[model samples]
Target: MAEILAFAGSNSSTSINYELVKYTASLIENHKVQTLDMARYPFPMYSADEEKQKGFSNSLIEFKGYIQQSQGLILSVNEHNGNPSGYFKNLLDWLSRLERRFLEDTTVFLMAASPGKRGGIGAMGVVQDILPRFGAEIASTFSLPSFGQVFANGEIIDQTLKEQHSEALDIFLQKLN
Candidate 1:
């Protein structure tokens, strides 16, 4: 079984993306999944000067270590004004500086969820474009729209969305195996 690292893009304690990812993680059988909270990794805003002066923080190093140890990634990103959240973008920046190929040799299962009708597809699109540069091979993508209406008790409630989510996840797991 492959080591899979899962995490959501937001730092919010009540992030809907986190809830979605957590539920998705539970659905995986046979694989070893490690889910993380971005709040646990508090990196300073990325800047050339910050890198030159202090180098990477312990939290960033630990986060990168998880990536290095994992062969697969399950990521759920939140949106901010039709773009990936700034917190997530900044984390990517810091990790990229630490190592340009942070996600090298790993396949990513990308996902997003939002209360809105579009879900977080805008953020998902931005992430889809960016992660490959860090060496992530995107395996599949899923978006759960209207999170409150569709998800409950750590499961996808809507039958159609559940089927779609299952298919996407099955494809990703198949690629990993």
Candidate 2:
């Protein structure tokens, strides 16, 4: 079976972005989805000094392994101050240190969502702009606005939003095949 790595960019225990990623993974067919929590695979706050002093951590090695082993990715990021949350940014930094094109040619389905109307669009914009540089073949992207109103029972509830999300997921899955 094809494998997909699904993750949220937030370390919050009750992360809505995590819920969104899990829900998105559920929509995929014939794929084994491994849901990754940034909190579980913790990494230190990245810095050039830290890299010079200690080199890459074991967690970062394993994290890169997960990315390399998977054929596809489903990710939803949380926004903080109009950017990706700090922990998520740190993960990216560590990953870059390990391999510049870690996500090269990997199919990616990117998403973002929030309680408000803009949905985590700011963070989503950042990921969309940067992932391609890592050689990510972005298959489709979705941003869910007013997440509290549109999502419930572990799934997207609003009809129009659900349809739109489903369309994007279908496009992503098609590209995976």
Clashing pairs in 2: none
Estimated TM-score per prediction? 0.98, 0.96
lDDT by residue for model 1 (1-177), tens: 999999999999999999988988999999999999887777789999989999989988989999999999999999999999989999999999889989999999999999999999999999999999999999999999999999998899999999999999999999999
- Runs off by more than 4 Å, candidate 2: none
> Which sections of candidate 1 miss by over 4 Å?
none
Tens digit per residue, CA lDDT, model 2, 1-177: 678999998889889999999888777778888988776877889989999999999878988999999989999999988898998888888898899999987999999989989999999999999998888998999999999899999999999989999999988888998
Candidate 1 lDDT: 0.94
lDDT of 1 at 43: 75
Sequence-dependent TM-score of model 2: 0.96
